[model samples]
Target chain A: SQTIHQWPATLVQPVGSPLSLECTVEGTSNPNLYWYRQAAGRGLQLLFYSVGIGQISSEVPQNLSASRPQDRQFILSSKKLLLSDSGFYLCAWDIGTGGTETQYFGPGTRLLVL
Target chain B: GQQVMQIPQYQHVQEGEDFTTYCNSSTTLSNIQWYKQRPGGHPVFLIQLVKSGEVKKQKRLTFQFGEAKKNSSLHITATQTTDVGTYFCAAPYGNNRLAFGKGNQVVVIP
Candidate 1:
C-alpha cells in the first residue's frame, strides 16, 4: 500500500520568517504531487503541482512556492512568510496521465504565522 | 475558468434520517470524484463516476453523475453520527488537476 508523510504536523512561525514544509510518498514512483492550503472557514486551495522532478505548475500566485527535489519528495517553501500565509498545508499525489486524475492526500501541516 | 459548486453549505440531520448533497460544475467534466473529510482529518476518496447518468453505490451511500456531466449528487441512507463530516465533489477540467467544490458540511445528530 502507498502512504504519504508530511513533516512538522504543526508549525508556528513569526511574520517575515522563512517557511519549509516537506512531503514524501513511499511505495510510489513518478507520482504527481500537489500542494494545497486550507484556510479557516475556507475550502482547499491548490497552490502548486509537480508532474516530475524540477517541473512545477503554479495554480495561484502567492507567498508560497513548491519544488519536487526528488521523485518521491516534495517541498513547499517561502523566503518570507506573511500573516496571510497561515493555514493548513496539504500534500497530495495523483496517478494520472495528461493532468486529469484522482488524488490521495496526506495528513497535512497546520501553520500559524504570528 | 472551470468551477464546481456544492449546495447546502451545511446540513444537519437526525441520525437514521436520509441526506443528500448536490454538486454542480460551471463547465462539462470528464469525470467526478467524491471525498469525505472527518472533522480534523484529511480527505478520503469515496467513489468516482465517469459515464453520463452513471450511478454507483457503496453500502448506504449512492452516487450519481448527471447525463450532461455538469452535475452530481451523493445520497446517504439512514445517516449515523459516524457520518458527520464534510463531503467534497471534484472533477478535472481539461487537465489532471481537479477543481473541487466548496463542499457540504454534514452534521449527524444522534
Candidate 2:
C-alpha cells in the first residue's frame, strides 16, 4: 500500500527564522502533492500543490512556498517565518484528477513560531 | 475561486445520539469528498460522493449528494465518542486543487 511521511513531527522556531518541512510518498509515482495549513480550531488552507516535478501551483500567496524536487518528494519552505505562520502543516497526495478524487494525508507537523 | 461552506461550526451531542453535518458549494461540483480529522491528527479521507442524488453508507454513516450536485451531507446514527472530530467536505476547485470548508467540529459526550 502507499504511505506518506512527514518530518520534524513538531517544530519551534523564532520569528524571521527559516522553515523547511519535508514530505515523501512511497508506492506511488507522479502523484499530485499538496501543502495545507490549519490554524488552531480552524479549517485547512491550501498553500501549494504540485502536479509534477518542478511544477507548483500556489493557492494562497504568503510567506511560504512549496517545491517538488523529486517525483514523490515535496518540500514546504519559507525564508522568514511569521507569528501567523504557526499552525499544523499537512502534506497530502492524490492518485488522479477531478473533484471526486480521494486524497491521502500524512501524519502532519505542528509548527509553532515565537 | 470555488467556495465550499459547511453548516453548524460546532455540534455537541451525547453518545448514542445522531449527528449530521451539511456542506454547500457556490458552484456545481463534479464531486465531493469527506474527511475526518481527530483532535490532534491529520485529516483522513472518509468517502467521496459522485452523481446527483447519490446515497452511500458505510456502517452507521450515510453520505448524500444533493440532487443539484451542489451540496452534500454526512449523517451518523448512534454517535459514539470515537466520532468526536472535525468533519470537512472538500471539492475540486478547478482541475487539481480542492477547496475545503471551515468544517464542522463534532463533539460527542460519552
Candidate 3:
C-alpha cells in the first residue's frame, strides 16, 4: 500500500515570513508528485508538480515554489509568504505510468497567515 | 491550458435523494478522473473514465464520459450522509499535470 505524509498538520505565521511544507511518500518510487492549494470554501489550485528529482513544473506561478530532493520527498517553500498564501496545502502522488492516473493525496497541511 | 468547468457549485438534498454533478472541458481529454474531498480534508480519488461514452458504476455511484471525450458526469443514487463533500472532475492537462474543476459541494441532510 502507498501512503503520503505531510506536515506540520497546521501552522500559523505572520505575514512576510518564510514557509516550508514537506511531503513524503512510502511504498512507491519514481512516482509523480504534485502540490495543490485550496482556499476556504473554494476549489483547488495546482501549484507545482514534479515527475522526478530536481524537476518541477509551476502551474500558477505566485509566491510559492516546489522541489523534489529525493525520489519520494517533495518540499514546498517560499522565501516570503503573502496573506493570500494561507490555505489548505495538499501533496499527491500518482503512478504516472502503467496506464494508471489515479492520484493519492496526503493528510494535508493547513496554513494560516495573519 | 485545458480548462475544466463543473456545475451546480453547491447542492443540498435529503439523505435518500439523488444528485449529480457535470463537468465540461474546453478541449478534448484523453481521460477524466473524479475526486471527492470531505470538509476540512484532502481530495480522494474516486474513479476515472477513459473510452468515449464510457460508463462505470461503484455501488450507488455512476460515472460517465461523453462521446466527444470532452465532458463527464458523476451521479449518486440514494445519497447517504457520508456522501457530503465536494466532488471535482479533473483532466490531464499536459505531461503529468492535472487540471481540476472548481468542484460541486454536496450537502446531504439526514
Candidate 4:
C-alpha cells in the first residue's frame, strides 16, 4: 500500500516569514507530484506539479515555489510569506501513466500567516 | 491548460434527499476522476470514468461519463451527513497532469 506524508500539520508564522512544507511518498517511485492550496471554503488551486526530479510546472504565479529534490520527496517553499498565502497546503502523487492521472493526497498542512 | 467546470459550486441537501453535480469540459476527455474531501481533510480518490457513456456505481453513488466524452456527472442518493464534503472532478490536462474542477461543496443538513 502506498502512503503520502506531510509535515508541520499546522503552522503559524508572522508575515514576511519564510515557509517550507515537506511531502514524501512511500511505496512508489517516479511518481508525479503536485502541490495545491485551498483557501477557506474555496476550491483547490493547483500551485505546482513536478514530473520528475528538478522538473516543475507552475500553475499559478505567486511568491511560492516547489522543488522535487528526490524521486518521492517534494517541497513547497516561499522566501517571504504574504497574508494571502494562508491556506491549506496539500501534496498529492500519481502514477503518471497512460495520460491519465489519479491523485492520492497527503494529510496536508494548514498555514496561517498573520 | 484544460479546465473542468463544475456546476452548482455549492449544494445544500436535506438528509435522504438526492442531488447531483456536473462537470464539463470544452474538449473531449480521455478519462475523468472523482474525489471527495471531508472537512479539514485532504481529497480522496473516489472513482474514475472512462469509455464514452459509461456508468459506474458505488453503493449510493452513481458516476456517469457523457457519450460525447466532454462531460461527467455524480449522483448521490439518500444523502447522509457523512456525505458532507467537497466533491471535485478532474481530467487530464497535459502529460500526466490533471485539471480539477472548482468543486461542488455538499452540505448535508440533518
Candidate 5:
C-alpha cells in the first residue's frame, strides 16, 4: 500500500518568517507529486506539482515554491511568509502512467501565519 | 484554460436520504475522478470514470461520466452521518495535471 507523510502537522509562525514543509511517499517510485492549499471554509487550490526529480510546475503564482529532491521526497518552501499564507497545505501522489489515476493525500500540515 | 464547476456549494440532507452532486467542465476531459474530504482531514480518492457515458458503483455510491466527457456526477443512496464531508470532482486535461472543482460540502443530519 502507498502512503504519504507530511511533517509539522501544525505550525504557528510570525509574518515574514521562513517556512518549510516536507512530504515523503512510501511504496511508490517516480510518482507524480502535488501541493495544494485550502483556506478555512474554502476550496482546494493547486499550488505546485512535480512529475520527477528537479522538475516542478507552478499552478498558481504565490509566495510559495516546491521542490522534488528525491524520487519520493517533495518539499514546499517559502522564503518569507505572508499573512495570507495561513492555510492547510496538503501533499498528494499519483501513479504517473496509469489511466484514470487517483491522487492519494497526506494528513496535511496546517500553518498559521500571524 | 480548462474549468470544472460543481453545483450546490453546500448541501444539508437527512440521514438515509439520497444525495447527488453535479460536476461540469468547460472543456472536454479524458477522465474524471471523485474525492471526499472529511472535516479537518485530507482528501481521499473515491472513484474514477473514463469512457463516455460510463457508470460505476461502489456499494451505495454511483458515479457517472457524461457522454460528451464534459460532465460527471456522484450519487449516494441512503446517506449516513459518516458521509458528512466535502466532495470534489477532478478532471485531467491535456497534461497529466488535474484541475479540481470547487467541491460540494455535504452535511448529513441525523
Candidate 6:
C-alpha cells in the first residue's frame, strides 16, 4: 500500500516570511506527485506536479514554486508569503501516469498568513 | 486547456431526500472521475467512469457518463449527513494535466 505524508500539519506565517511545505510518498516508486491549494470554502487549484526527479511542472504561476528532489520527495516553497496565500495545501500522488489516474491525497497542511 | 463545469455551486438537501449534480464539458473527454471532500478536509477519490453511457453504483451513490462523452452526472439516493461535502468531477486533457470542475458543495440538513 502507498501512503502520502505532508508536514507542519498547520502553519502560521507573518507577511513576507518564507514558506516551505514538504510531501513524501512511501511504498511506491516513480509516482506522479501533485500540489493543490484550496481556499476557504473553495475548489481545489492545481499548483504544481512532477513526473520524475528534478522535474516540476507549475500550473498556476505566482511566487510559489515546487521541486522534486528525489523520487518520493516533493517540496513547495515561497520566498515570501502573502495574505492571499493562506489556504489548505494538499499533496497528492497517482500511480502509472499523471492526472488521469486515481489520486490519493495527504492529510494536508493548513497555512495561515497573517 | 479543457475544462469541466459543475452545476449548482451549492446544494442544500433535506436528509433522506435525493439530488443530482452534473459535470459538463465543451469537448469530448476520454473519461470522468469523481471525488468528495469533507469540510476542512482533502478530496478523496470516489469513482471513475470510462465508457460512454456507462453507469456505476456504489450503494446509494450512482455515477453516469454521457453517451456523447462530454458530460457526466452523479446521483445520490437517500442523502445522509455523512454525504455533506463538496463533490468534484475531473477529466484528463493535454499531456499530463487533469481539468477539474469548480465542484458542487452539498449540504445535507437533518
| First chain TM-score for all predictions | 0.95, 0.97, 0.95, 0.96, 0.96, 0.98
Alpha-carbon RMSD, each predicted model: 1.1, 0.9, 1.4, 1.2, 1.3, 0.8
Q: After superposition, how far is residue A26 of candidate 1 from its true place, in Å?
A: 0.8
List pairs with backbone clashes in candidate 1: A99-B95, A99-B96, A100-B95, A100-B96
List, residue by residue over B1-110, the lDDT tens digit for candidate 5. Answer: 56799998999999999999999987888889999999999999998888999999999999999999999999999999999999999887545577888899999999
lDDT of 3 at B60: 96
* TM-score against truth, every candidate: 0.97, 0.98, 0.96, 0.97, 0.96, 0.98
Better of 1 and 6 by TM-score: 6
Top DockQ prediction, candidate number: 2
Question: What C-alpha lDDT do the candidate models reach, one value each?
Answer: 0.89, 0.93, 0.91, 0.93, 0.91, 0.92
* lDDT value for model 5: 0.91
Query: lDDT, candidate 2, residue A86?
Result: 98
DockQ computed for model 2 against the true two-chain complex using alpha carbons = 0.81
Candidate 1 per-residue C-alpha lDDT over B2-50 given as tens digits, one digit per residue, 9 for 90 to 100: 6889998899999999999999986788888999989888889999899
Candidate 3 per-residue lDDT over residues A1-114, each given as its tens digit: 888999999999999999999999999989999899999988888888888999998987699999998999999999999999999999989985612489899999999999
Clash pairs, model 6 backbone? none
Ten contiguous residues minimizing lDDT sum, candidate 5 chain A: A94-103
Cα deviation of A16 in candidate 4 (Å)?
Answer: 0.7
lDDT of 2 by residue, B27-72 (tens): 8988899999999999999999889999999999999999999999
lDDT of 5 by residue, A42-95 (tens): 788888888899999898889999999899999999999999999999998888
| Fraction of native A-B contacts kept, per candidate | 0.50, 0.89, 0.59, 0.72, 0.46, 0.54
Comparing to the true complex, what docking class would candidate 5 get?
A: medium
TM-score of chain A of 3: 0.95
Considering DockQ, which of the candidate structures 3 and 4 is the better prediction for this target? 4
**lDDT for residue B22 in candidate 5, whole number 0-100:** 99
Locate the minimum summed-lDDT window of 10 residues in model 3 chain A: A92-101
lDDT of 6 by residue, B33-87 (tens): 9999998788899998999899999999999999999999999999999999999
| lDDT for each residue of candidate 4 in A52-83, tens digit (9 for 90 to 100) | 99999898899999999999999999999999
